[model samples]
Target: MSGLAILLLAAGASSRMAGRDKLSEEVDGQPLLSLMCRRAALTGLPVYVTVPSDAHPRTGLTGTATTVPVPDAAEGMAASIRRGIAALPANTEGVMIVPADMPDLETQDLMHVAAHFHGGDGPILRATSENGQAGHPVLFPKRSFDDLCELSGDQGARALLKRDKVQYIALPARHAITDLDTPEAWAAWRAANG
Candidate 1:
């Protein structure tokens, strides 16, 4: 994890949650963004969280994680991904994209994905559910950095992921895909997890 950075994508509008902010939703007694940054930190990787702006409220909750301000946050996930990639350290050998809304992804889950990344020759590592459902916290090697930096719109890295050779790491249960975008989704998750 030393040469790798974790990008906690948190600049989305959460339009599906009505007027509520999904990243602000509580998980284990703290905001989801803060919890995710803390968990990513546990993996010993440099955590960079993308917020809507430098003054965005989520910026204050990122703790020790470096906050990457997304001035074009309205452009969607691609904007945050581009800025976050550009913000990574000059020597970073790999990067892990951890969507902040995935409240169930634990420190161990992240480590599992990072553990698969073996530097210069490492294939793109994508975390999947135990049952083989492809999902988040995807790790990309430095060779793919240019493509990531060229990303546009809300599509994220889907096109790149589809075209690249990826190795999947499975985490227990639904930890790899539990993204809570709506209030009902949050309620369902909290009720089940708590």
Candidate 2:
């Protein structure tokens, strides 16, 4: 099966964390990026992370595969998506775009999203929280590659969600929309999840 390749976006500067790199932060003794990568790997899918060139030395996923330094990441997430898409293997029929900060995303959730894509029923498959809030790790048909690459600034695929062809799969996990950005949000999420 030519499964959807997962592009884990970890290039953000985390300005809200105020000098701390959130992706490298430890959750239960594991770097957030490493845990997310490991979790994604459980699905037997090819998982690659896009990290800044100067990220701290973190051994948690030392030998894991990754792509370095999205040149336009400072411009925002759309650039990371474009860089990831550009680096994809020729056999990658489609992709699942995920943010690095979703520490609570489970393998079953990813499998659900990918299954929706593999079913050949939807052009775009979005994962939503049970409460109806749409979120990341969205699956895009190969046809959207051109538009995704052409996107700029902070847009990051929100426009694509507005398209008529987009369909959604509601996931029971609340982690679908939660991420640790500010220190308070991080602490709160940690406390809640713990």
Candidate 3:
């Protein structure tokens, strides 16, 4: 074990997708949330998945990952972030925060990030596009857990990241930044990548 855990944020309302729950959307015959969880699990790290509630459909698809229901998930990304961080195992020394909506993020992409985490102490590891655009699956050391838990609104950890030293790890193409939120985005991603 890398003394690390994966936090898959799936509590978002996906309001941008109208009535569609983007996490529940199909990705290669499985729910996007399920695929993400499986990918995270493949890293052999503990995974904590946040959902709107225990009854939400996402909870059913979590598979081996732990389910953390954020009753205040409507309050936005921070609610899930705060809740997910608290749910990680007691032995976790670092966390890789992955948004569940990025269909292009494969198991290898996650492993690439996990491979860079060095004993839970060092500069934060943030995945970047091949062209150097800063993006998702940020790996934070144990020292930053409090700051992450203190985050608010839908901004996620952008504020905490700005205050810390972040080392960027380049992933192929726009894999780091390709998060599909709206129907149009999904359609375009499907068309462009298919």
User: How many residue pairs clash in each candidate at the backbone level?
Assistant: 0, 0, 0
lDDT per residue (tens digit) for residues 1-194 in model 3: 46888899999889999899998888889998998999888888888999999998889999998999999999999999999888887778999999999988888988898888876668899999999999988999998888988989999998888888899999999989999999999989889977
Query: What ranges in model 3 sit over 4 Å off?
Result: none
Candidate 1, residues 59-100, lDDT tens digits: the string is: 988989999999999998999999999998899999999899
Scanning candidate 2 in windows of ten residues, the lowest lDDT window is 54-63
Clashing pairs in 1: none
Which candidate's TM-score is highest?
1
Q: Give the TM-score of candidate 3.
A: 0.97
- What are the models' TM-scores? 0.97, 0.91, 0.97
Note the Cα lDDT for every prediction shown: 0.91, 0.79, 0.90
Better of 2 and 3 by lDDT: 3
Worst 10 residues of 1 by lDDT: 113-122
Better candidate number, 2 or 3, judged by TM-score: 3
What is the lDDT for 123 in model 1? 90
Ranking under lDDT, best-scoring first?
Answer: 1, 3, 2
